[model samples]
Every structure is written in C-alpha cells, then in structure tokens.
Target chain A: MAETAHAASREHFGSTSRRDSWWLAPGLVAAGLLLLGGYATWAALQGTHFEFGRYLSPLYSPKIAAPWWPLSPALLILIPPLLFRSTCYYYRKAYYRAFFLDPVACAVGELNRGKYTGETGFPFVLQNLHRFAFYLAFLWLFFLWHDVWDAFWFDGRFGVGLGTLVILASTGTLTLYTFSCHSFRHLVGGKLDCFSCTAAARGRHGAWLGVSALNEHHMGFAWISLVSVCFADFYVRLLSMGVFHDVRLL
Target chain B: MPEAVLHVYRGDASGGGLKEYRVPLEEGMVVLDAIHHIQGHQAPDLAVRWNCKAAKCGSCSAEVNGKPKLLCKTRMDALPPGQPVVVQPLKAFPIVKDLVTDVQWNYEVNKRIPPFTPKPNAEWRWKQEDVDRVQEFRKCIECFLCQDVCHVLRSHGRTDAFAGPRFLVRVAGLEMHPMDALNRTKFLKEDAGIGLCNITKCCTEVCPEDITITDNAIIPLKERVVDDHYDPVRMLVRLVTGKKKGE
Candidate 1:
C-alpha cells in the first residue's frame, strides 16, 4: 500500500486505535451485498427456471421475447434496477466502505490511493445519472406491480398462493426502496424553496415530507428489497423446477 | 457510591499515555462530571475544555470508550459497568495539552466557506417548511464531534482537501436556504473537497444534535455538485437552454 504521512505518525491500512468491533459492520456489509449480488447474477444467467404455472421470477418480469434476443429475458429487465441500485445514495456508502475499503471504517486506516476524486470523475461520476436511473426504476415499478397482479392468476382464475405473497413482498419492498430514493425525494420536495408560496409547492411539500419519512429508512428498505427480490425469483425458480410445490392459499 | 476508573490521556502533542484515575461516581453523573472529580481531587491541572455542561455547547468533545462523544452528555451508567472508560483527545486534531486539542483548524475551515448571501431583490417571505429544512443544519453547535468522527480527517488526514462533515452541514444550510443566492458548487468541488467524503454516515451517528449529515446535508450538496460539474445530460440541457444551474 502507498503511504500517506500524517502529523501524528500515520500507520498502514486497516490500522486503528479503536477498541470496538469496528471491522464487523463493513465486513458484514461486504459479505451481504456480495452474496445477494452473486445470487441475483447466477439466477439471471439461468433463464430456464424463471417461470412457473402462474408466477414469474422478478428477475424475468414483463417477459421479453424476440427472435434476435436469444439471451435470458432476465438480462433485459435487470439493467434498470441494477443501475438504480448501484447508483443509490445508501448503497454507494455501503459498497464504497465495504468494497473500496475507503478508510475501512471511521477512523480506521485505508489504502493510500494517493489522490481520491470520489464521485467527481470517470466511472464514479456516472453516479450523477442516478436521477435518470430513478426515472427508469420508477417506470419499472409499474411492471413489477403488474407482475404481482399476475402472480394471483392460477388456471386462468384469480386466486392467491404462496408465490403471490412472495412476489407481493418483493414488489412492496421495492416500492419502498424506489419511493424512498434521495433523487426522488429531491425531485418531489427538496427543490422547492417555498412550500406555501404556491398550491403546487404545498402539494410537493407534503410529498417531500412523506418521502423524507421513508428516506430515513432507505438503507433498511434497500437491503430488504434486495433480499425479497432475490427470494421472489428463487421461490419462482424452485416452483418452475418442480423442486418446491407452490401451496394455494386462497 | 461506586468508584469508576477513568483512563484519561495525559501530556501533549509530543507524546502521551493513559493515566489511571479512580473517581467516585454519583447518581445521574456524566463522564465530564467524573473528569471534574479528577480535577477537584487528584490532578488539579487535568486539562479538559467544557461549557454549558449540557450537550448543547458542543464543548468537551473526546473519545469515550473508543467512540467520539460529548463528555458532558455521555452518562456514566451508559458505559459498560466494570471496564475502565478510556477518555482520549479528539485524534483528528493536533493535541494541545490533555483532552484539549487545537480545534482552531475547524474554525479556519469555517472561514474558507462563503457565508449566506441573499439573492438580489430577494423577498424574505419563505414558509415554515423552508425554515424547518434549514433549521436542522442550524442545530450544529460547532461541536467538532462530527469532524472528529470523519475518517477523511481522522484517519486519512485529508485536512488539506476535505472540509469534513461539520462544514458540509454548514454549506448545506446555506445552499438549501430559499432566499440565499451564492453558488458554492465550484468551491465544494475544489477547496472544500466534498467528493472525498464516501458518505459513511459516521458523522451522523456521532452527532449529538442528530443532524442527518449524510442523507440530508451531504448527499444533497453532492447532487448539486453533480449538476454543475459531473452530469453530462444536465450540462447539455444547460448549454442548449442557456439556463443557469440549480434554477
């Protein structure tokens, strides 16, 4: 590791005077994100078991089919959500600290990359497109909600099942995640300087307040939504493979 | 009365080590109270700075039990019952004597930021919502606890570039103000080094005032910075429409 000198005699990477379990947070965050990401990637690659009788994997929602596009349908649908998540404000913090080891944990030593530009240039600068991705993610939410609605159709009859509940949980958590986005919060309410000046502004202020409330727990929603989406796909995959029987709930 | 062991750091910038002092704990007492007991009885010159013994003054910022906290606010009972509570100077700044470090660096950084400049022909008729938004940032008592907890300053020693979380909160207050006009995005990008922050939320965790430093303050400011400097689409729109940024 490259060395950066300090007035107090700086130490090497990962060095810290902290006595607490400082490494636990970043370690778990890295492992969790990697594990979830790995599962999603693997599931996306396997196009065969993405659908059951009524339920469709969230990874392959809106089931795209074209003669030219022979690849997994999941590949087409996952990009927007992946971009939205990869650029998310909360996820950026998690992955940056966990994967980049940028100061590892607070007050803990980090690798000396000499000049750290953060999100101002190159690939990192692409994070600025988060707002654009937010639009796409917001649009995709409609598709996800549609899939949740379709999950109830069994033998051309509307009925609830375990798969319906799983898909519902996925869509619900994802809705929370998308609505609680910082960009969405800014677009809805944060931009307005005077809320009471105009009727529209007042309406936006109410939206901002609601978004702010949800934004407070954006990190929690992010994790839960990630897990739920993966679980939704995993359950549907199992059902499609006839490994796990889907129980009719209604 | 239970006696608590206080492991307080002694000496100055040259070097120092933890000195064990046993203080008699009192009912509803704080870590600052224990330090005061040490001053009153054992060591008369145990240098520790404090004011408004309430958590409001932002004084007496130190690392208690390996966490950056206000000594005046840390309850004695809140710490682990048996273990010695270690009190160290804010490791980010240059040590002055004991627990007092040269926090003047923060004040210097405070000077570099442009003050709130009201917009030209501005009507100061903002609603309570605007007030509530900026009011969260105004709650900062200049504690420097957020500064101490920030790893860019604390560990990486990027005081030369990064302006830490405290000043970022300051910038957020000014930038978010409806009537305010001055654009500091260039300054935020260059001198203040807003990009260096990875948004760990450590500053938010350690803040006694509970200001949402990362999510509310820093991230919004980062978005503004992105608008002016990084985003191509926004830049193209500005270029074509001849619209000023943040309009």
Candidate 2:
C-alpha cells in the first residue's frame, strides 16, 4: 500500500481464479486432437498411407538424428507461459476465472496459486516437462525434414532430392525461430551472462538476437508455431495415409 | 432496448455486498460510461480511479464481470448481457475506493530490479536487434492489471521474494539486450525469486498491449535462474572457463 494509489493491502486485491477447465468446448477440441493423433499413430503403424509401414519402422532415421542433433531439452515453449502466470497479476485472475469458475470453458488446467501439486499434477505443471517434450518434437521435425529430403528429385524413386533441401531449410528456420525463443533460450541458460562473453557465445547471441528479434513478437510465433506444428502433423498423416502426396520436385 | 444491471461491490474492508444499479443501455458505450452514470446520478461518493479514458494510460483496469480489461476500452455491447456485469477492483493490489487499487507496488518492484548496466569496456553502439529485445516491454502502460492479478503477489504476498510480471518484463528489456553488460541473473534468481514463477500464463491472457509476458519474460528469467541455481554442469563449465552468465 505504500506505493499504491489505494489504501488496500495486497490481501484486499485478490484473484478470483485462473485454472482453466479441460472440459466442454476446450475438452471437445482436445479430444478431437487426440483422435487425430491416434489416427496418425495408427496410420504410421499400418504403413498404408505415406509409407504407412516405414513411418512406424524403428529402422528409419529422421533428418536430425541423435548423433549430431541440434535439438535440446530447452525447446519447450510452455515453461515460460507457465512461469509467467505464477508471477503475473493478470494471469492470476484469468487462471481462476478460466479453470476454477466454469472449468468447462477453460482449455487447460488449474492452479492453487503458488502450490506445485506433485501428486495430482495440474496442467500448469506440464510446463516443467516441456524441455523433454520439445526435444522429442524437435527430433521428430528433423526426421520429417530428412524424410522430405529423401522424397525429393529426379534420380527419384519413392524418395526425393535437391528440392528436398527446401523442406530442411523451412523446418530448420522454424525450429531456429522456435528454439531461439526467449522461453527456450531461458531454458537453455540464455540469461547466463558468461555465454555473451564466450567464443561462439557472442555469435550464438547474435543468432539469438536475430531470432529473439523475431521472437520478441512471440505472440506471432505462438500462433505460427501452433499452425506449423498442426500443419506438419497433417502432412505427416496425409503422407502416412497415402491420402496425399509429397509432390517431389527435382 | 434493454437495461443492464451493474453489480458493484459495496462496502469497505469492513465488509461489503454486491449492490445492483440499473442503467439504460445504448450502442457504442463502454463500461466506464455506465459507472460514471451511476456515480453521477446515484452515488457521488463512489470511489473509482481512472485517467486518459482513451485506454492509452493503463489506469482503469478492473474485472469486467470476470475478465481483466481496461474499462475504457471494454464495450458494454461486447459482453454477455444475460447475466449481471460484475465490476470489481484489480485483485493483486490493495483497493483505494472501488475499482482503483494501489498500483505503486509496481513502481517499488521496478526499483528493486537492476537498472540497465551498459558494459564499460567498449563503445556503446548496439545492434538494432538487441534494442528490439527489450523494446517490447516498453509498450507496457503500467495498468498493474498484470501485477494486480498475479498470484505470487496477490495470494502469497511474497513481495520480498518475487518481483511480479511487470518488473520481470522491465528487467528482461534491460538484461537481454546485447549492449547491457550488467548481469542481472543474480538479482533475478536471488533478490527477485525468479524460480517462484510457475508459468501459469495468466498474465499473457490479460495483457492489453498483447505482450507475451509469460512466454517472453518470465520463462527467460526462469531459464536464467535454472542456469544459475539448478544446472550444475553449466556452472562448472562456466567456472572452469572463467565466464559467468547473468552475473
């Protein structure tokens, strides 16, 4: 109250709630996503669609395989948003409004203010596991790009060639933009001052600055990432199902 | 064509109930207009704080029914009229009268954060990209809606621990810039309690300027905290190399 306009204590101003209900409209949407994911998984197993069988094959290697992989655990984007809510005034209010109140209207999980419920984990806690998830997603993306590469060109069989480089570049740029995020960067020790002074650190910072510049408009990336991930999954699914083609241009 | 019910929280900290006031409806009118009409006609002593009614200054933030919004920009017509429109003070800060809460918590938090520290070793020229990193935070209007609604500040009152989202963004602007030499990671982890934030993302939802407060600021700060405190390997590597990050 010393710095505030009102005489009210911090206690006087409190959030209604911010936990979103993963039911009703949001739940239905999530269910649809689950169904699509399930179908994609199934299609990959069957090898009827894109390579119905090969996509499910453990023998196949993705574009960015484990050996020289650039993808790390820091790529998770959810952590920042989650961490932000814990410290934000608006998020506290919205958190309660969305999840605690009508729960059904909310698309995500709930919170107990500062409590990190370990046993019956809430959606808010999913942010912590983001680093690992991002690693898997990034790995998959690299593989998909590799698959696109294998599918391109004239000496062409079922695989590709030169034009396939474009897919690799597109995915690479998207991953760079996503991974270079303030959130992901933070996850990877980006806020570390030493990195700025080190050899590749400065240049990486330069690359980060380039990406972060694009990232500063993160709400843009948030939307585009959402769209890209969905589109990428759709492409994979279509190819898996044989319902669509990769259209090799060599 | 219809009348709207204004559900006002009546009473001081002593205790208050919601008082209902009926207002005539019109097109293109904002919630602020109705509050003003009610104040002028029925309750002259009704306490509310606002300025720059154009929504440029973030003074008039309040819960419209339940959402955090600048009353000036919230069109009454956009809200669902079937239920009572509940207008309440911002939740994170203390209430002065009605819709106004003490926003000074923000200014104080801002003070605790490290100021922009430019490295003294070299020329001051900066990349336009570096400048862009922190500039997004400048769009903040100090509505404190983000501060008022934050659970750490509101529910826990950990003012001594956390700096809240508003200050986090303020700090991010200064800390992330390539031109800034002052390492704020220590302050972020220790003084500011960056690890305390759980990334619930409630701030991103209510930001009027649409700044991704959680994704852009808190996450990065948390990452910094992890590098400083949780990640042992990175620390050893940095120590061996004689380079300290967020120092």
Candidate 3:
C-alpha cells in the first residue's frame, strides 16, 4: 500500500489565504445586512412616518389596524418579508459565513468548535419557516400592488408624483426578487419528472425555465430589492415628516 | 511552436510551491495532457493521479486557474493564451504529492451512511416519475469536487460534523427512493449535520454532472430534517402517539 509513504508525504499549506481581496465581498455583505436590519428595525418601531399624502411605506403596507392598534404597524407586516429573507437560500449562505463564520469563504479556515449543530436545532431550525413564509410573501405582493395603485391618487385625484414613482420602482424590484427566489423556482416546476407528457406540464416547464433565468440573478435581485425597499420606506417617511417635498409629475 | 506555461504545484505535505514548466501546446491539448508531457520529458518524478483520461472517471479532478475542474476536461484553448495556467491540488483535502490529495476522508464518510434498505417482500414497482429525482442524484461519480467546494468541509474543517454536499446527495437518493423504507432524518439532523449547510449552491455551481445539489437535494433534505425535529404539530403528534411520521 502506498498509504504509509503517502501519509508521510502529507503537507499543509499554512492558512489558505487568497492574494486577492477576498474579505471585501463578505465584509460588504455584513455591512449591508447590518445597515438594512438596523434601519428596518428603527423604522418599524417608530410606527409613524409610514404614510404620506398617498404613499405608504413598503414596511407597513396593507396597514391592518387603526393608528391606536398598540402593536407597531411594521411588526404586523414584517412577518412575511422577515421570514422570506431569513430563510432565503442565498441570504442564509451570506449570513452563515459573514456572521456565523462558517468558514468565512471558500477554502478559508473557519471557527474550529469541534462540533457543529446545523439548522436542525433551535433558532436556526426556524429557517425552515422559509417555505411557509414564501406563501405569505407571495400573498403580500398583492398588497404592494394595491399600494402602488393608491400611490397614483393624490388628494383623491388621479395624478402621478415622485412618491408614486418610488413606490412603483420598489414594487417592481420586489416583484423580481419574489419571482427569482430559489423556493419559488422549485415550487413552479422543479419537482416535475415529465415536462412534455402533458399540455399543462409543458406550460409549467416553460414557467420553470423563466424562473430559472431569474434565479441566475437571484443575488443581484436580493441586493437591489433590499435597497429599493429601504428607499421606498425612507421616501414615504421623509415625505410624511415634511423633510422632502413630493414633486408633482402630472 | 505555440507553448503554454504550466505553473504546476510541486511539493509534499511538509511544504511546497508552484514549479513552472513550458509545454508545447497542440491543437486539442488539455491541462492533463500538458501535465503528462511534463511527467514524461521534463520532471520524471512529477506526481499526478489520473485514469481513463476522460471526464467520467473523476480521477483527474484538480483546480485549474483557481477553479475546481477535472483536469482532462479543461482544454488549453478554453483558458486565455499567454498566461500561466495555475494547477493545484484541491484545497479541501490534504496534499500527498504534486496534484494528488488524500481524499480518503470522503470514503470514510460514505461508509457511515446506511445503505439502501427496501421493504421486505414489497412489490418492486415504481413509475418513472417517482424515481426521477433520485435518478438525478444517482448520476454522481463520487468526484468529491462538491466536497472540495463546500465551505462547511473545505473551509470550516467540519468533516466530523458535516457530510458535505456529495453525501447529502447520496442520502437524498436513499431517502427519496419510493421503495426504500429507512428514515435517515435523525442521522441527517445529528450525525451528518445537515443544518450546517446554508445552501450556498456553490456545490451545484461547480458540479460537472449538473446535479442541482442545493435546490433539489439539499433543500428538500433540510425540509425533512425540519419536519422531523422542529415542526410543532409534528412534535405534538409524536408526543401523543409515541411514534414518528416515518414509522
């Protein structure tokens, strides 16, 4: 057996560090997620500035209760998006490496805790909620569209404004994000065995391909939609606080 | 004659670095062919493991230009001309010599998994659709590239905990088999450490067989783990009946 000689020949390269700037990507992801989480938390807690003349913050859209509902309006509507992002296949990797340091990057050494309990345990296991949360997120899109419809009406008259455009852009990007989800792709037709056996199955296959195309850009959509949601909320909040003027485009 | 600079990694476990060799390039030469030329003429002692010289055997797996690929499949033309094609052993495994790494750990992990267990005296009948997903996983050639790219094993050194993407695909095939009656959810949750994978899809990206490791296999297996361990309704049912769903 060459095992003995091979065992003797084993060599270790000291800490496989890349020459290029590998830390920059994960560092950016960490900063971005942190900024988004902090901003969303602060905005959600305030409960005010989520609405203006016609615009509603993406964070508190489909305002389910009265202003005196006691609970933060953001909390009421945060469940769907929170579950979507938390259980997101892509975001899971991002945070797992960025925050958990589960081998920070490819080939880079990670925290040697000797034992690892994956998502099967407590809070991490909650990530399984993503599939269920996907249903909620799919349903929440309608409310965002409804808000977009309301955005066009200023003072009850049909007119376009800066808030309308912002809300529209936000909804558009979120639509891309929703459709591009890995879960959504699997749900569409990833489980099918025969794509050409039936007429409806063929159509489903086509839809799956379409979703697969978008899934290729799932990461890009994730970041863009995240930024767009924050911008949408900030736009509505600033307008509500009289910090920014709503330019009439009609 | 057109030539390419091959910066092949040369050294044993104690220490090593890249040793450059200029090989005369042919019209259809691959990186493996260049290595063979170097082994034949220049460095007779240069060590590289290969068999079949085709993409199927999975023996010539290495990192070409810092990407995990089968050496026989990566053509010289595919890489940019006038640049040194850096070839190295897989970073995830321990280097034995030159481009050969000790991939025995993967075989060890494979042994821990329970083999396919079919029901006794059960009629063996399944529609093509039923086994189609499992068939996708059956295409694995044990290349270990998935294990190489996996951060849980390659980066985090969680070989003890995580089974990497390759075994997860194997478990997926067993668990999803319509005729197989064994429930590996417990093993998946605890022993294999399925939760450690955050579904980066890097394994899928690097897979030459086009197996959808993350979406089709790993994610669905993760769901089974969650249903068995975490679901409140399932937990309550298990408490009341003293029996699991698979039972």
Candidate 4:
C-alpha cells in the first residue's frame, strides 16, 4: 500500500491549486462575450432587421418580406442585465458561489435530506426522478438544434450556412458542460461496478478531461449555464426576426 | 450570557452514567469550551481528548447533543435553547474514557485500501487545476461526522459491509484526482462497500465545509464504477481496439 501510494503520487501530476497562470480562461471568455454582444447590438440598430414575429417566422412558410414593425421592446431592455449577470460567471469564479450556493440565494429545490422517510419507497422514489430530469436535460441537446432551425435563413448571409454549425458547436459545448455535472452522471447510473465497462465510452472518454476543465471553471459553469440558455434563446429570437445578426467570422 | 447545564456522559466501556454540571456560557462559546470549563473548574478528572481548538485537527470530536460534530466549531447559541446540552463519546468507536473514543479503527480502515498508484512513468509537474480538484477534499479535518452519521455503521450496524462515508470521501478524493492515477474503485466497491450509501445525503448535511458529498463525490464515483464494469459496449471496444481505460 505504501509502495502504491508513492506510485500514485508519481503518475498524474494532479495539481489543482487556483494559481497556475489561471487568468487566461476567464479573460478570453470575457473578451469574446463582449465582442459578440457589442457587435450584435450595434448591428441591430443599423441593420433593417427588428422584425417582431421572428420566432414565429419559419413556421410562417414560404417566407414573405419581414414586417418592419417593432414589438414592445420592454422585454428586450431586461436582456442586457440578465445576460451580463449570467455570463459574468463565465469570467469570474467568486460570482458563481455568491449566486448559486448562497443559502438565501440558492434555487428552492435542493431536496433537503431532512425530508427523508428511511422507508424503501420514498427516498429511492425521489432518486429515480433524477433520470427523468436527465431526459429533460438530454432534450437540451436537441433544443439547440431547434434554436438552429429557428435561426436558419435561406435569404440571409448567402442562405444560412454556418448557423447550424455554430449552434452545433454551442450545443456540443453545452452537452460537455452538462454531462460533466455530478448529478447527471449519477442519473446515467454507471457506478455499479468496476471502471472497465463496455457501454460507458461516452462517460469514460469525457470524465477526465471534461471533469478537470469544468472543475476549473465550475463557478463559471454554475453561472453561465443559466445565462447561456437565455442568450441562445434570445440569439435565436433576435436573428430569426432579423432584429440582430450574430454577424461574426469565427 | 446564561450559564449552561452541561450533562456530560461520564463513563467508559464499563458503562457509567451522566454527570451534570453548570458552566458559564459566553456569546461565542463552543461545546468544547464548555467541556473545558467543566474540566478545569469542576471536574479535573473529566477525560476528553482535544488538541487544536480549530476544527482542523479533528481530535475534539464528541457527540454534541447526540449529533457528531467537531467541538471547537459548534456554537452554543446553535443548541436548542431550553434543554441542557447533552454530550457523549463517539458511539461507533469504543469509549476510551469520558468524551474521547478510540478512532484507531478509522485509520485501520484507511490502511486496507491500496495507496495511490499513478500511471506508468507519469512524472510531470503538477498542474494547478489538478491540485485544486483535491484541495477541498484535503479540507477534511477527519472529524468523522460523516462516519458517525453514516447509518450503515451507526444505525444499521453494517460494520462488515460498509466502509462508511468519511473513508469513501477520502478514497473518492484520491481516486478522482487527476494527479493520482491509481484505480482504487475495485477496492472501494469490494472492500469499502461503496454501494451501501443510498444517496440519503445525510453525510452532506452534517459536513461543516458544506462539501457536496452525495452529489459530487459519491454519486459520480458510483457512475464511473457502473460504466467501467457494467457497460458492455465499452468492454467490446476495449477488446477490439486493444486499448485500456484508466485503471
């Protein structure tokens, strides 16, 4: 055991202190979000797009010329503050803790263990519900596709080329982010035995690199998760209506 | 501040009785301080094991009002207001004297698991992120609140089947760590009995550091175990490709 302990110390070089040139990840994300939001907003007023029924566009079939009429932009005003607070976690770790784990500030449904009945029925019953939540989260992977579909335009930007791909990248990233979550992994129910299983390729392939990356920006994920969904939905709505163009070359 | 009547369980394995005494309760007095007051002023023979008053040392653990907590951090005000505070020795470990219990068994349980074994020739400079992953686990003072509250060993008396939460957290911290490449999951399941934790989340509730034990540590490790052994497609891939997952 002593020999093995010494050996374990030698292999992985696991150092997780917060100080190893750590400013780069958040710094880059902050600059990128700023650039994206700034460009999108500036293009909104200058561009002839501010169509109200944009989300309702594709289903409108054989797309007609967009009506220039503006919807009540009151909801749009709330977007910036919400977006800023949400994406701020992407840039700062402390913000995540203050927002999510705060005793008073946390989401209402932590399923306090204090409520357990110790019976075979209730506690385990509630635990089984997580798998359903997993399915709900799994639907997000496709919702990004839905957002991509909604944002697609045959007439805009040489007939909708990279929008799907961009949304795919966003969705892939979001999937990586969500699957790395401790709760979702448990719901997938893989921890019943040895680590060398056959069907767990997705989980095992993703666990190490994914866990380490998310662990680094856990605070960011905690906050940005709430923000990204809102932003993605907004991006879809804004672009579909031609109110804003996510005009950028990646 | 009102004086508190501390009813200390003042016996050993031979079985003794509760001895009650009053101590002056200050605004920020911990249960340990009250114990100390009783020891110094009233019962010098009162036996209690303590070193660092800070919660880091893990030595001053006693069942405060029947809940396992590090004595130094438990504030007197947090106690139920009207009842006399009841203190007892740790129930799982055999009583050494009054408030101290023999925690040597925990160390023995720790020893049975093979130590950390990294991957081959894996000498690399430790990454800061990797260190951060294990840092919170490092925060464990080993107060054994998780162990004490663990129903497997405590209530159900599954001493032979379960390794309890404290050790599981220790093993998970070491195993999930990026730097430590040792595959200790087999040891955890067979010897440590990781399956006994039904995700009741009782251990997480008692942890003073607020570490997400059930969700973060235990459940994820459990998922990994399931994937490794139970996932048939992974095994077929490993068989066909002649590759191995981290062991």
User: Evaluated with DockQ, which candidate comes out highest?
Assistant: 1
lDDT of each residue in B21-105, candidate 1, tens digit only:
9999899999999999999999999999999999999889999977899999999999888989999888888888999988877
lDDT tens per residue, model 3, A42-103: 99999788999778999998888667668787887897898898888889988986887664
For every candidate in turn, the CA RMSD to the true structure comes to 2.7, 7.9, 5.0, 14.4
lDDT of 1 by residue, A52-92 (tens): 98788888887887668887777888999999999999888
Candidate 1 B-chain TM-score: 0.98
For model 4, the docking class works out as: incorrect
Put down candidate 3 lDDT per residue, B1-247, tens digits, no spaces.
9889989999988889999999999999999999999999999999888998878888988888766889998899998777888898888888989999999888878888989999799777766655666899989978788888786666556676788899999999998777777889889887888888877677997788899898779887776775677667668888999996554
DockQ of 2: 0.25
The per-candidate TM-score of the B chain, in the order shown, comes to 0.98, 0.92, 0.96, 0.92
Which runs in model 2 stand beyond 4 Å of their true positions?
A: A1-144, A151-250, B1-3, B121-127, B154-160, B177-179
Question: How much does each candidate deviate at the interface, measured as C-alpha RMSD after superposition?
Answer: 4.6, 7.4, 6.2, 15.2
| Model 1, residue pairs in steric clash | none
- Fnat of each prediction, in sequence: 0.43, 0.15, 0.27, 0.05
Give the poorly placed runs of model 3, Cα more than 4 Å off: A1-24, A31-48, A62-80, A99-101, A111-125, A129-146, A152-165, A168-221, A241-250, B13-17, B77-83, B118-128, B237-243
The list of candidate 1 runs beyond 4 A from truth reads A1-8, A66-71
lDDT value for candidate 3?
A: 0.81
Per-candidate TM vs. native?
0.94, 0.67, 0.79, 0.56
Q: Total clashes, candidate 2?
A: 54
| Better structure of 1 and 2 per lDDT | 1
Q: Rate residue A7 of model 3 by lDDT.
A: 25
The alpha-carbon root-mean-square deviation between model 1 and the true structure, to one decimal in Å, is 2.7
Error of 4 at B190 (Å): 1.1
